[model samples]
Target: MTGKLRCAVVGTGHLGRWHADKYAALPDCELVGVVDVDQEAGRAVADKHNVPLYDDHLAIIGEVDAVSIAAPTSLHYRIARDFLSAGVHVLVEKPITTTLAEADELIELAARHGARLQVGHLERFNAALMDLDLQNQPPRFIECHRLAPFKPRATDVSVVLDLMIHDIDIILSLVDETPERIDAKGVPVLTGDTDIANARLQFPGGCVANVTASRVSMKMERKMRLFLPNGYVSVDFQNRVLTRHQPGEREMFPGIPEIVSEESVFEDGDALMAEIRDFVACIREGRRPLVDGQAGRRALATAIQISEQLSA
Candidate 1:
């Protein structure tokens, strides 16, 4: 809380290694250590960053002021709970935990210890999404598609949790309302869990979102389209492009109104760094994070509901 905040990255796998690198490069943070169940993997990252390596998170929990948890979804609750109970701030990856009850417990534990709990809803930091001018324009209809080729790394959870949850969080944030009902369907292709799924969410205010995610696709695509009362907006997450369509003053024909289209493209931005910086800033400033425990809980709750419908 004084000079520079000490931080550690737990579960130094594919994503956790980058978390360690970012913390090491940040000026306001000190990369204290890295933890991983795989000792070789952890040691490799630590050596590259010149930080200490630990086999277990418990060994480094007392050494850091904050921790980034990129562990497996099943271990999220236990790992995050231990750190938060120790009064250390946490920035855990998305879907906070496997169950709603676990998420609720983590939120309560963070508050009890006065520790900040942030969720890694990475897309919320997307440059294209961040640039959208959707302040007053509430979307009436939202459509999302996140497709990717099969990868064996995250097969422990269904595609809904692994991929669709990103769009779910974004839709939930934009609507700011709990969904009244959910209809979902899914099929398992390459894993025991659902590899491709679709969900329809209806909010109280008549806003609806149709989300689809597939891990067995041939190509990768990450896109979302929002239909607002005054216009339509499209965001391409992979390419960092935003396109807007609205009515123009001029008429195209006798009775038809002209439509104006504008497109904005952005460079591949560093969303993870921004997310980590925000977490550190919140901890230092005593402010709430953009994606806090409650928001994470909401997204998880909705995702669970969809998953249940899929199973039924």
Candidate 2:
């Protein structure tokens, strides 16, 4: 709240290492420590970031005002529960936890402890996504495709949790309504878990989102197309570009044209850094986080439905 907020990066694996670097480089945050089950890897990240390393999170939980939980999906609930119980604000990575019950418990824990819980839906911080004027109206229909080549690093969970959950969170945020029904299906291609998946979410507000994510694609692509009453918005995550097709006025065309295209490229910014900044800002200002626990729960609930359907 004062000079600099102390922060720790937990689960110093691939993603957590980057989280540690961001905290270390943030002007208003002091990187207190990096915690990981792998002591050597944790120490390496700490050394690189010039922060202390701890194999156990308990040692540093009392010291940091806020922490980023970038650990595996399986460990999210336990680690975050412990930190939040200690009154430490947490920024947890997506799919919040393996089960919806776990997510609910974490949300309750944060509320009970008066600690802020922010989910790591980093796309919300993307400059391209942030520029969208989603204030007045929610999306009517959405399509998302997040495809990537297989990487052995994040195989602990299914592609739904590993990748599709990102789009699920984004769609839920845009729609802002409870999904009435979700018809989903997926297949395991490369790993033991489902690799490529698709879900059609029907929201009570009549907004439908057709989401697909695959980790076995030959070419990498992360894009979403939003269709609203007034216009269509297309976002390219990898390219940092947002294009809109809105109806043009009489000056631009004889009558109102069916659509007029406008393209814009966002200034290159680090989304992960922005996400961490938001977490620190919320912790400092006592302002509610953009992707709060409720938002995360919505996404997680949708994902759980998809997974259940897939399993069935």
Task: Give the Cα lDDT of each candidate.
Answer: 0.94, 0.88
Model 1 agreement with the true structure over 51-137: per-residue lDDT tens digits:
888888899877899999999999999999999999999999987999989999999999999999999999999999999998598
Task: Please provide TM-scores, in order, for all candidate models, with all chains considered together.
Answer: 0.98, 0.95
Alpha carbon lDDT of residue 82, candidate 2?
Answer: 94
Candidate 1 displacement at residue 59 in angstroms: 0.9
Error of 2 at 44 (Å): 1.4
Q: What is the Cα root-mean-square deviation between model 2 and the actual structure?
A: 1.8
lDDT of 2 at 148: 98
Candidate 2 at 154: error in angstroms?
Answer: 1.8
Error of 1 at 204 (Å): 1.2
